[model samples]
Target: MEKIVSFIANLINTQKQFIKDLKELKNHKDIMVKDDEKLIQQFIKKKAS
Candidate 1:
């Protein structure tokens, strides 16, 4: 599950540069529905920081 989530996050990251902020990732509620929220949140937070 982590691997799958990581892959999905990686895909999302392709557009992350356009994101412009960590808050954007936090507001993307639809992502929580498609993947593990904690995992994705952590990943995005770490990368954003």
Candidate 2:
């Protein structure tokens, strides 16, 4: 029983860490998309002018 509990605790900890990493990755992706859009807009403005 004790070993089972320990295993479960470890699994929960790993899952929590995975979730945190996933959130960070999503945030990073959003920032990259926004940066890319800004760059494209600037390019278009330059071309128009």
User: Which candidate wins on lDDT?
Assistant: 1
lDDT of 1: 0.65
Give the per-residue Cα lDDT of candidate 2 at 9: 100
Clashes of 2: 0
Quote the lDDT for 5 in model 2: 100
Model 1: per-residue lDDT, tens digit, 6-38?
A: 999988986675454545655667545345567
TM-score of 2: 0.56
Poorest 10 consecutive residues of model 2 by lDDT?
25-34
Pairs with backbone N, CA or C atoms under 3 Å apart (clashes), candidate 2: none
Q: State the C-alpha lDDT per candidate.
A: 0.65, 0.63
Q: What's the lDDT for residue 26 in model 2? A: 43
